[model samples]
Target chain A: MSEGEIIIRAEGLTKVYRRTSGGKGFLGLFRRRTEEVRGLTDAGFEIRRGEVVGLLGPNGAGKSTTVKLLTGILTADGGACGVMGRTPWLERRKIAADIGAVFGQRMQLWWDVPVLDSFRLLRDIYSVPEARWKARLDELTDALELGGILQVPMRQLSLGQRMRAELCGSLLHEPSILFLDEPTIGLDAVSKLRLRDFLRAENRERGTTILLTTHDMADMLALCPRVLVLGRGRLLYDGGLDALLRRYDTEHTLRCVFDGGAEPEGLPPSVGVRREGEAWTLTFAPAEIPVGEVLAKLLAAGPVRELTLKEQDTDRLVARMYADLKLT
Target chain B: MNIRAYRTAFAVHARQVSRYRGAALGGMVTQAFFGVMLVALYEALAGEGDLLRETATYVWLQQIFFRAFFSTGGEIYEQIMSGSVCYSLLRPVDLHLWCVCREMAAKIVGVTMRLLPMILIQFVLPESWRMLPPDSPVAFVRFALSLLTGFLVIAQVNMITAAVTMRTLDNKGFSGLINLVMMILAGNIVPLTLAPERLQAVLRWQPFAQMLDAPIRMWLHAGPAGEWALSFGVQLAWLAGLTVFSRCLWGRGIRRIELQGG
Candidate 1:
């Protein structure tokens, strides 16, 4: 509603999916069973206007479910969520004019139609004024580099080109907020970087609030300063990305080639050791035991030939977080 | 809401439907083959007379507009299965009305693309198998209006099929069931006139008959002013009933829809 206002808020939002398991035998056929699977549970967060926030979660952790609920695509089974100060599912059509969404696994464009035709259809559907529509279309086409593929059918475009076109389509209406589910999934390095840059510019220039769900930690690092992490249908963390990473990123690895048969031992049990072809790898959380202390222990145990230290990769950090939370 | 948006959707869907000219050609050939076989079978059983003549026209009309009887909601199925239907749901328009308009466009355009070629088969067939002209100019007019009403009814039927597909997550069972019932009761399998006398009245008044059988009968025999009114009244009644029922089903289905993919 205003600058720096809360544009999106979820309070104890939850969803449980009813899954039916068909019966097997003749008598069992009449006794079909329906099981409720928790999709989201008591998930809550607040997103300010123009803020870019990433949703981090392992598979089936309700990241997409959260997006769907916020976008009015699915109704939450418990609690409430408000977008632009209105309940999304209750006022879905009213909110439709103010928000746009892109799902990476799905194509909103018509497969057999030319890209521009689909754009035109969306233009009319959103009721964008003709003059503003043309101007916005032109700008988006240029920005997303979809100018050359305007006349191509969606099925004929490469994945990278199609995703760019999808971004352009979602932005042409100048929605106040955008929801992207796995927007950069299956994208090449160059395309992913370009997509991140385009999204950043869009947020800056239009002050469009963005809520993106992605498995790519790099995308989260580059685009979202703040993130909400969900695990096992529950909110695990909600704060700055750096803070979340720092909490779990303490685990560090050191690999060193021994000069001879000097066995590396007598180190604290907190540190894990593994033997490779020519080097021994040691892993220890810097928070539990200081990196310097572990290094000294390793040096005393073996004559180091070559050594390198590496922080836990983001993918592993997330995996470890999930493991710690018992979400896997 | 600009009515123009709905009109544009109709236009776009019509364009999409018109793109399948090749399919229409293939369908015409198949329909003509079926038409010839049905007419020959009817002639051998019924002998040459007014009954055979009327049956020939009925058979030809069935073949001519066969495309309309099939569901034109293939895109809805694809969208639902692929989870792309979220885009359709996200649009500001009423989802039910939008789908109705789309299916209407597809049915009209899909049938028109094949109508002429299939009609031409009437002239090419032998004398006994040839389709007859409408009973009179007034009958033709009634037939035209009734046929348009039939499209509305079938469009609602298509939407119902889509709703069922959403509920079941499988279109084949309901789609096939609907097709079979429509073929048997709507006179596509055999003209209701040729059916046993006791069953004829019941079959003629059923909802499925409103799709084409009732309209084609007007073309064969435009009985009287009162009969014309009754014929159209039945069609409109069925259309209204179906529209309401399908809307309810579709609204409920959409509220609980869980798209197939992530």
Candidate 2:
């Protein structure tokens, strides 16, 4: 598929899990109950080739269900989805050749075997040509800094090393589309940065389309330019990540540790002030009151010992978004 | 057919199975002890001559190939239980054939490691208690072929169990139940030959009998050619039937998992 071509498209996609419960006693077995749990409902979106898209949501907000549906691991109970011009569920085998998925919490590589052996098995599984396989392996191992650990068994590797090995294994066939679910989970700062760098390079050089689902906002900010947000099994937002963040990025805070002084007065009523143990925190929306105005008012409170201006924590921003959408 | 891919999976599983040399050694000692005890018991109970010798041989063979009944498809169960089965289903290769290859590799390699050592245990025993040789060279050849067919049947059985596990999620209960049935019916618990005359006809023809009971009987006595063909026919029929049934069940199980979330 060419760049900008619609590679993944879903319309009115939905999934409901009927959980059977309350079948404890002999009589209860006859009166068992099934609770319908919504996974995703009427979700619609279009992802073009070579785009890095992040899926964002609170826990149980259908983020995983969306990925599973698009990857053909789970079929939609209602509506339809197409990946690479073919229905994903119907042509899963065909699409399997073109798509690679990595679940952060799971290891796809053989646990007891050396990493290279697992890669060889994957090469055969995807039927990648020997020459292409060699080149891809070399490139991935070099880029992921996995050359030193190729001979190490998967179970022996550290979490970061294993994640890198998994990435290499999934990319060995040079699939056009890559789905990563929490790929940066449990990684150190250096490893996460390296992962993001490699992913950015992969997208740039190979035009590999990436669909990522991560709870890490740093990862989202670093990798994905666009995002699809799901809440309570509904599509809440789909647009640029900046736009989504900006919508929730209304509030800014200024914390001041004053040297024995009275609280700030004469500030606008919109600014929220909370004092604890001589440190006064001033929280206000930038849209409603300017940062300079808040800072000026805080200066008038007393001689400040230490002052820190902070943007909203991405995690808190997400929490706020979840609250705004009633997804908590 | 993706022969290369399946072969690669087989090799990997074989390597993995061979890694547990310690477990195999421990198991060999236990099996040898059982073999001696069973041989002694049979020698005391059965009448002297072909019947005693045949029973002793049957006990030895059962003890030697005990690993064959084990489901080497542990990886299949692990994948399903841990939800990593998603990656397995995502592979472009045929899932059922991949599982079969894995189990076959594990079974063959696992049994081969202890087969010779366990067979040698017979030499240390007294002549009367020792396992007797096959009826003839031709009989030995037939026994080998039939034994291999038995492995395939067991692999299919393992596949069917795996399909059930896909839905049940916990295979311990089902596998325990099935293992007990397989042991009694396949003559691992007690040789079917010792069973009453009335049940022998039906028991010998059952699918579980096709695993080892039928094959080892060939070694004891090579029946008429027509009888041999009939026995082979039963083994092959069960192998084919179980394979198709397991594959169909796996297809349905996959659909359920896809619809319900793994």
Winner by DockQ:
2
User: DockQ for model 1?
Assistant: 0.41
The prediction achieving the highest lDDT against the true structure is 2
lDDT of 1 by residue, A84-198 (tens): 9998878888898899999898887777778888888888889899999999998998888898999898889999999998888888888999999999999999999999999
lDDT of 1 by residue, B1-262 (tens): 7576788878888988898988998998899999999989988897888888899999999888888887666566787655457667777888788878888888889889988878776777789889899999999999999998998898898888888877777888988998898888888988888888789878878999999998899999979899889879989999999999999998877766732223
lDDT of 1 at A146: 90
* Model 2 CA RMSD to the hidden true structure, in angstroms: 2.4
- Segments in model 1 whose C-alpha atoms lie over 4 Å from true places: A1-3, A22-27, A252-309, B81-87, B196-198, B258-262
Per residue, candidate 2 scores C-alpha lDDT tens digits across B1-262 of 7899999999988988899999899989999998888877777877467778888889889988889998885656798766568667778989899889888888899899998898877777788888888999889988999999999999899888888888888899888999999989999979998889999999999999999998899998888889999999999999999999999999988887777787
Candidate 2 residues lying further than 4 Å off, grouped into runs, are A1-3, A23-26, A256-266, A274-280, A295-307, B82-84, B196-198
Q: Tell me how far the alpha carbon of residue A110 in candidate 1 is from the true structure, in angstroms, after superposition.
A: 2.7
